[model samples]
Target: MNTDFLVIGASITGINVARELKQRFPDTTVVVIDKESGCARHSSGRNSGLLDAGFSWSPDTLKARFCKQGNQQLSDYCERNGIPLNRCGELVIARDGDELSDLDEIQRRAEGNGVKLEPVTARQAREIEPRARVHEQALFFPSSASVDPAAVMRQMEQDARDAGVRFYYETSFLRKAGDEFVTTLGTVQAGYVVNCAGLYADQIAQQFGFAGNYRLLPLKHNYLESSEVPGAFRTHVTAAADLSGSYPGTQIFLGVDGKARLGPAVKPALWREQYHGAEGFHPFEMSSVVTTGIGQMFQGGGEICRACLQRFTGSTHSRLITAGSRLVEGIRASDYRDWARPEIQPQLVNTETHRMVSDFIVEGDGKSMHLLNTVSPVFTCGLPLASHICDQVAAATGR
Candidate 1:
């Protein structure tokens, strides 16, 4: 197969890049390929679907800028395409005076970043979410929204097809054969290549001598959707901090389909694509919510997760443990039936620093662009990120 631009990985980033290229250079031929059978099976489909309020990072960071603009861009995309969106907003809750201080810092950061954060009193927070354990205060992000990422990617894929972008699924991009890529299905030659390959992006770019020392580490996360706990959540409520500051903070989501979900315990996985069984991927226990923070859920960490819940939030309603560090009330633990769709993200580890790389890493000049760490809420920043990456490719390759 031959095209002007070849995009690897069928995630939202790749899809957005393809479409953007087509829109900019309508005469240019764009071809996209993915290792998966379908577009959204991997991390793109398995996330909490919360568009970051554009408030989580420092104002100077790239994450803060893209996320702030990306949230609104995506909201507009959903509106134009009939994709479902709940602009119900989000709440960052504080458990006590200590956590409330964190909220104050977050508000300062948000104001600096030009992201709107409204402070609410304990009574106001309870009015917003009665079940939420609001202690001293809560910050409301009015621009935040709950989005179905899988739906967004699906729509992008369709729109790309309509615009003449070709998709080759189940296609593995092997080593480069001179100026072309040798794939399992066929040989692909293009003026430029963009690798949005989430998990193996660094490896692909390494072949072209980019992304100097980044290696992917699997961060496994799973959620338990209660069978009996009715979807009672109105707005998205999440914790203020991860405490350890290692992994992500717990955020509870009420799906457009009427299911409330908590968790996504973050831990390292031995293998990227390997799953032990339902117990590992789909644990269905009440106490399993807290199991992720202490250790692996498959081990005896369920009690630890439960213990953390009792210790921090002071509530065991199954709905509130991962929500934050506050003592929430009104919500009770119900019988949880099974695990929701679990996902593992490619957490880029700087081999030299031996730490998780939080920022989006882009390498390559005009010839190729490799997007490493395009995970999670990156979907929120897809449109602009795609535009920026494509512009780089355009400049580098003179396309």
Candidate 2:
């Protein structure tokens, strides 16, 4: 097979990249290949579906640069395409006086990022959501929303197809030879390649001589579905314990159908696709992850160690219920016994510096471009990020 542009993954990033390339160079042929049978067979379909308001990142990061714009663009797309969307809003609450500073910092970031966040008192927060438990004050973002990820994924796939993009499913890229790529189906030649593989991005990039000092540190995010009625909680309520957006401290998110779900107890995984027990297990990948985690624990001033401890302590059913109880006026542990579909975040860590890469990363040359670290908020930042990447492609190839 031959094409002008080839995209490695068919998820949101890869599909949008192919669409953007076709839009930029209308006469050129664009193709997308994925190991899965269809789009969103992985993380893109199994996420929490929260459209983040772009307040958790510093203004200097790429996440901050694209998130606000992406959120707006996605919301608009949903409205125009008849996709189900819930304008549920978000509440960032402080447990006590010590954490009030975190709310202020988030507000500062919101201001710098051109996002709207309002400060509300305890009484005012109750008016917004009767179940909320606030310390003294909280920040309310009316622009935060939710959508059905699977629905959005289906729509995006159709849109890409409508735009003259070809998709090759169940075809995995095996290796590269000279100027052609060896795939499970066969070899192919391309003018340019874009790597947006979620879990195995680093491994694929290494074949092209990129992502040398980075490796994916997969984290399992688990959620619990509340058995109560749909409108149990009016909006999303999250604890302000961590502001790095690395650990989504105890949160209750309302789905597009108005059902409330609590969770995302973040814990490190032993392997890349270790979503459940003994499922998708790879021994070699487990060994590599363990070795890298041990190195990070010792060299990064025990930051990873502390994070692991927190997650381990809070992941249990009883412990998770306790944490959730503090965020809302919840009553029983029996209401949240059912666990939702688990998702994994393929976060990147700097192997040399032994620190987590907090921002988005892109490493490429004239022949190919690799999107290495697209962690949380990438779903919300997908549209704008794709346009930005296509801009780089234009500059590199003079298209």
> RMSD of each candidate?
6.5, 1.3
The number of residue pairs in model 1 that clash at the backbone is: 7
Instruction: Identify the leading candidate in terms of TM-score.
Output: 2
Put down candidate 2 lDDT per residue, 1-399, tens digits, no spaces.
999999999988999999989987999999999999999898787787889999888898889999999899999999999999999999989878888887788888889999998899999999998888899999899888999988999999999999999999999988889899999989999999999898888888998999999977888888889999998888999877656446667788899999988886677889998988998889999999988887786676776677677776788877888888888896478899899988888888887877777788888889999887778889999999899889888888877
Residue-wise C-alpha lDDT for candidate 1, range 98-128, written one tens digit per residue? 7876777778878887998789998898787
List the candidate 1 regions with Cα displacement exceeding 4 Å. Answer: 228-231, 243-246, 275-327, 330-333
| Poorest lDDT segment (10 consecutive residues) of candidate 2 | 240-249
lDDT of 1: 0.71
Off by over 4 Å in 2: 244-246
TM-score of model 1 vs. true structure: 0.85
TM-scores, one per candidate: 0.85, 0.97
The lDDT for every candidate, in the order shown, is 0.71, 0.87
